[model samples]
Target: MIGFVEQLLRFASHIPTFHLNVQLLVDFAATCEAQLDRWGILEDVDIAIHYISEIVTNTSNGDHDKLQLALSSLYRERAIYFGALDDLKSATEHGPKPQALNDTKHTSWPSKAIHAGRTYLAHGILLKDTVKAQGYLNKATDLFEKVIAIGSGNIALLVYVCESLAWMCELGHDAGAEPRLRRHLGSYLLTDILDQQNNPRVSTGKHIGRIGFCYLCLFKKGSNQKDLENSIKYYNIVMNSKAIDKRHPCRCALLIGLGHAYLYKKQDKWAAHCFKTATLLEFAIPALRMDACFSWAKVPNIDLVEVYSNALKIAPQLAGLEYALSHRVDNAKLLKNLVQEATKAAIAGNDISLALMWAEQGRGIIVAQMLQLRIMFTHPGIPIIQHKEPELADSLRRATTSLHQLDALMGTMDVKSTRKLHRDGVRWNHLVRKIRASEKAQLGDFLCLSIEKILQLGRKRIIVIINAHGDGWDALMIRKGDNRPQHISLPTSNERFSSLRKDLFNAGLRERRSGDGASGTTGSDNTSKVKGRAVKKIGAQPPPPPTPDSILKIILVQLWNEVVHPILQELGISVSTILP
Candidate 1:
């Protein structure tokens, strides 16, 4: 059957009728990729892809929308393989960009603009060029809107519409139409289950999750309560879904999103509950758990110290061990809040050990807090996996090496790369299943440094930490042989501290005066991962324009009166002890 299909491709160009014949060729190529070792030769995918390109090159306009959409999907399907290959390099270090489907034609069935739009969006995501990505997004936005205006019955199209909108918002662009359809997604989706006779598609949790995200984006920009409600509704749908298991990693993020939404609604109890739940889900990835734990601390009137402490205890994975020092720094920066909040919780509870641990972590002095710990161990290193499954690791390494070498020479619709990508993808999938079956390492106590390690690093030095998180500033004094760090509640407000930090950065004070103990004195710890991280703060406000001298004088006076002088007076260190 495969051999006969190959015979047709050789003389396909001569055939006057194109659509059905060409689809057979494309379908065959897809089959070969799906089951390469079954019947078809490896070169068949290459030939099919090549032939499709020639046919599409001539079928540029008018009526080939269906064909174009099919080609686009094929392009996207192959792109996923590239993304996977790129991701495999993440076992220990970040990998370089993988090969993309660069040869996909701009063809989409004219009637199915949404399909074409989707293809463009997929291709755009693979491209590094900002302008091109935006262009593709814009085209997708237009196509989605046109179909939506006609009120198409293909409910699946509705999900992509919301996805495109959310993606556009992420890119700092908006078509001003997200709320139109997604806001009332309940009206469209009567039942959470995808009845095969109806849409016949599953993964409703994720589909609705996208709709929820669209609403989330809308609420962020406009502060519309309705949008917030819609987002919360959709997120809740996913959370309560029967088809989506509780252990699904995607639910972990949904829970966090739910936590944030509830927080915004002034429903502190629900918000805290959601965050606590997300933090405790052991099956979830460690990075997300860390984020959930961090969010859990921000909810006022909630004593999540136990939860936070538990999250810190589970460092079984290698999230923070990224490619470079800068990567580590970024990772640490991500969880700078985890450090700040941990310190605050410690100070409130008078837990000296937690205070010292967070103090060091927030200073970004010790290795980056698992900040860049986004699940995938990035950076393409040559070391084989050192786990018990050496043979499996060796297989993974070989697959990665093969993909890495071939990625450099491949182009769009390149069959060779596609076949290799498929093979590796299968290997990776199998490896994942095998590892899951073989993996037995459980969560353990990890984040806290031993007393000996801290003492060695400090060398009897007094570690003074000024933490400015939540409502006010806190100063912790870590001395040798003390059961706990002495916590001092400072007079400086959290808002004042953030503004001051911002001002110092603007005026180059932070850069010029490095290693000052005041670096951790930030309401945010300067994170940009979550939008409105500052605005969400109880008394947060924009920083006043650069007033270097005034800011310096205020900070110095506060330090002297509230921090320095008090410490000196208590320790009996007078002017004589400070003589240099």
Candidate 2:
């Protein structure tokens, strides 16, 4: 029965309804355990469970994909076991009689257990069930505590286990266990990243910041002073590493994590100092900087506006013509919070035009990726290049496809994945530069619209860009003579535009929409973004708050009077008809 349930779980995870099915499986397993207890063989179940585990281990052999699946196997299996045990404890009307002394131990379980525990840890952190989340987290802590002790200090075993744990920590679980295993995991990771003369391998610093997170998680759980110190210690060390001291993608996460550790340790001044240093790092992603700013604002007497203003000032960088549509989407979502803060700051400073530019950058990520950029080789606009340089076009088409497919992944990268991503990023940039350099390509500007270019677009006619901010609306108008954008606070709010960034991205326009007032401002929210919320069935819930035709129209009419009418009036343009 245990083996059958485990196999069922392995298959179930690949399906959409796995969570819905888990409770039923847990109940069924409990019933089977109750029957086993009646036969005085309930305690032998652990042996059967581990026996199947050995078969799985032997089957996985040396395949990496198989290894992760094995980890996922243990993860789901233990969750089932724990659920069944809970069923027994519930004293349900009819439930399993689980054996009291249930030990989940076996040789070579350390690495497998840690891997599975990490997946469970990610799922737990993301789960909305606070009670259930905490329950599984405790189970994981106990599981890690038990298995980490069994393995002797083989450096390979220690390094693999430590790498898994550090990345798991970076996945941001609200879990910290007793200090011993965490320190062991973090210490091994730090061993590789710290400044050392004898170590032949140069650290890319990709996974090094994760070590700080491992120790931070430890400090959270046990309140161990040394764990917090070690977290800070490695954070500083990793930051100062020759690789990280300069601009590096890894620095994005490191500064944020370090800020948190300092916050926890009451080193408020050092934490604030991180914000200044982060601001100096030209390449650090804006979204990450926003997070650091929020954390720094926790210090008493600090100006809140000043902190978020820093987030606002960090401009969104172009994704370059080579970036995947999905990558551009990811980058935009990351920049959203900072854009929001920046917009608010603009409102405070009465710099309406500046806020609009920031909002333009934040919304319509795909729009930004394609518009103002020359067409791809397939597009008719680039026919001359495609026909003349057919071979180059083919190379570009293939390389561009490979680059997009490579960077679209949405999970943690081990060292191998990190190297792969870096290579693809490099290769794609090289190809783009090569294409641009070719005289025959005639691409002109294969890039997103520059702020100056966008302003120039408004020289001939009026262009009003409206963006939804929280529950309100703000607008920027560009007229011919006054090259600078003019701001208008629209009279009404429409929630549909709140997700304008996402909707415009999903639209992914085939042709850039032009000759419009507030172009790309009113992205259609025809699709829904439930975002893990339960989807309602037909007639399942009351009618939604009056949407598109009603609230949206009202907002539009409000814009006509408050924004367009005034601009046109100022321009001496006549309106033939008047509206109430």
Candidate 3:
């Protein structure tokens, strides 16, 4: 009977299309019914009936798209069924259930609520219907409250419910939801999960990092110094521990969170160090790097705008007025122009949704501009003085001030507080610090620099010489007035050399031949007897002495070897030098 059920599931799993296979589902239901009858297990019969009913309801409509959705719904149902079945089988065969499961009280209300809420949320998103989505989210919230009322103290279940509520609140900021989210989170104390002597989860630093994250989030909400301290403490524990797992998401999040917290406290140096550590953690685990956009917005750019705008309210910069007017052509000015264009587009469209989307995109562009300014100001290696292009700097400062003012005015609707602004500021500072400390140190710096320089100096200009050989024979040349280096060819008896010479000439390099019919003179005939005798005694033929052409080649080769090679090496170009 077990083998028959496994075969049925295996067949169901292999359906090529997501559309519900009604015939296959019916077969499965029949098989389950037969098995239930044979075993006469009342619980199994009840479960099978529930599954069949849900599956039938889902597939009743039978449009291909609806069928596909139904199939997806069934997938989750099957997962829950499999889990339940495994539990039942284990109870029958083994001595007892795991202690954690044994301790967890079964609450059907919460389980039913979670399942229905998930279905509604999925349908809301799939249909892109905001009203329906909110309805489902409300249902989910109600279910979560019922679970809390049951008072089972199931940490996993509570965490999952709280996270879901937090996500729903974030989807569209519902002011009423904040208190509830906080109340749910407050239930878990430090001692609830942590072991007495050491953190049981931190067998290898990953769990310690996760524990730190939980603390960091708590610190953000409650302003608890102990939570922040414990976060950093656990971070240090992970960093110092030799058993660090490179793939751990917890480690990456903890490092990033630590960096943001330190930045919030105005400890710029410490914040930068934390950010640098976070960046390294991201490299070790690339999935974490996507959080950069969110992290960068927290500190120097967004918060700086808030701080400067508040300051500007009392003390308007007369100097900034003159500067902004003079540099009306810069990026800040350009961004303002784009925003105006976007606003015009919105007004013309006459659709509120389109207008809101355009306005949001425009805001993003403005934020990007702010990020660029913050990057210029705070990046460690780029000496701040170098950014002293008076007009451009003035424009950036004005723009920053202007954006802050805009944010404040907008704050009547979306008012961000000083604390939130400060938190964001610290986060940005940390990110800058982490980027600087990356393993590919110079590579990171170069990448951050203006795109033009990256395209120009960093790109390699290869000069391959055909048939050139010897310790000093020059195979490549870059003329004083030329934009790129040129290749040169030396005389050779082989057909490969003949083809190579043609290739070099085609590639814009000078080609000259030696011997009677060639353009250049033969130097073998000019070898001195004394030098030839010395070469002969050493059992080696003397190399042909330099002619005017050869001397030019030698000088050009020497110039490249001494000058270009070092520059290329410093730029991290891993190309081999062409030798003659």
Candidate 4:
């Protein structure tokens, strides 16, 4: 799965960013690291390391800055793991090399600064030496400030630096070199950027709300009257901003910030009012809600069990919920409830893959693995070696279990445990290699065919992949034997598509409501005949006027006419004679 996902990511790197989900890829990478570390397969760890490095090396012709960021992130993760495992030599070796930033032509200065800061931050966290840690932290802070100063026009870089700095401060690694209020200079700078942008009402409000969070951080750090005053000022700006939408998540965050500020000012009534208003908001940001819950918990008298419970029911992955529950409530039943809610939330969020990954991490590894096996075996177009060689599946499962057990035992790494892990890992690798060889023979290919290979299968044929990008859709097409995929631009832009999607959703809601109304009137004898005719009429309603599928077909036809047909004509396909 890791190898397959890596291939997809590498392929995506060659395409436009609209077609890729970078955060999803990062989450997958994190999952891979977590699973590999949990299983303690030292051999496969090297394979993963090599695979990620290969991505970095192969992506030089692509987006250099994004590629460098990804490479730095991977190195940072590896270094953190190695340091935690007490492998100082490997940790140092895995740390981002300053030489990587020397290529000014290929690498942007912002990218270099961000990567260097991240590297130093990772090292500072992992290193046990306080003096070295402080030095690294200072260096990181300096690099971040440099990027913030130089990359003012680069919103993305500025955001990354500011967020990283905020997180570093939260981790208490800032070394207290700067004054408490001045420590968050990056945050204030971000506020300036937000202030300059002529953004929409809701967007500007959200930006300002986030800036208010920076002041909240200062208040947390100092707890002085001046800090409290500054925090209140920002919170008031957010709350009074006419640009804020009532339903915006930023409104919730601002209220939460105000709650904290009020709490600091020892105004329990105002604090409670802020917390209550925040919780009542139509669209609550999960992180902010968690903070609100934590704040309410700190109050001398208040009941938040219902709030936390219901909030978790909505989004169980909300940060700080677990900690508050563990320390404040500490009930096993509640924890179990949280786990169940999280599992359901993951599935509901259209991320079944993440749910399965979490299941393996938690209590149901075997169950999740079995379910995955069933999916793989039953899924069309997917090759499964388990059907042809059942013994191979059994062997693989056993090897995996053994690997996990060994990993658990070797968590506290030492020379003896390390050697044992390596030995077992080698044995595991031999089994996997043999299985892969056999599967290759049976399946003819170990993974999905590339676009180039797929295009080679037939003449005068095109393989079109429709991808959803935010509110829009993009079609990538490859004609037979084509060297590159052609992008087919649709006539309908993202904003238009978004409006159409909303219309479809509203129509669906109306249909459901009408169905419910009919259900309640089913037994009325006078209306039975009317209901029968109504049902017949509805059944014959010409396939429900322009559903989302039909809308997409319209766009597809537009694409075919506007983009693909021209290319086909250029390729001497005789489009005049070709039939739809």
Note the Cα lDDT for every prediction shown: 0.56, 0.52, 0.42, 0.51
Model 2 regions more than 4 Å off: 1-107, 125-132, 151-231, 243-249, 263-338, 372-449, 493-559, 566-578
**Residue lDDT tens for model 1, 312-413:** 543322123212234334554555665576677777787776776757655753333233222214422212233555686566556556555664565663
Clash count (model 2, backbone only): 0
State residue 228's C-alpha deviation in candidate 3, in Å. 4.0
TM-score, each model? 0.49, 0.51, 0.32, 0.37
Q: What's the true lDDT of residue 90 in model 3?
A: 25
Per-residue C-alpha lDDT of model 3 across residues 1-580, encoded as one tens digit per residue: 4346445544544663434455555455455544322221223333333344444444434333232333334433332222233322222222111332233355334444444444443433333335655665665566556665766435554544554455455455345665666576566443354434243343434444555555565566667788678767766666654434433434555567667767656666676555545544432222233233235335563433222212211111111121222322343444443333333433334432333333333344434334544455454544432243344334434544544554465445332343233323323323433343344333243212232322253245432222122222222332333334333222322344444445545433323333323433223443434422421133465774445455456546754665456445543477587656
In model 3, where do residues sit more than 4 Å from their true spots?
1-141, 151-153, 162-190, 195-227, 230-244, 281-287, 293-580
Q: Global CA lDDT of candidate 1, please?
A: 0.56
Q: Give the TM-score of candidate 3.
A: 0.32
Candidate with maximal TM-score: 2
Please give the RMSD of candidate 2 to the true structure. 17.0
The alpha-carbon lDDT assigned to residue 571 of candidate 4 equals 49
Worst 10 residues of 1 by lDDT: 91-100
RMSD, candidate 3, Å: 29.5
Q: Could you tell which candidate, 3 or 4, scores higher by TM-score?
A: 4
Distance from true location, Cα of 119 in model 1, Å? 8.9
How far in Å is the alpha carbon of 45 misplaced in model 3? 31
Query: What's the true lDDT of residue 35 in model 1?
Result: 39
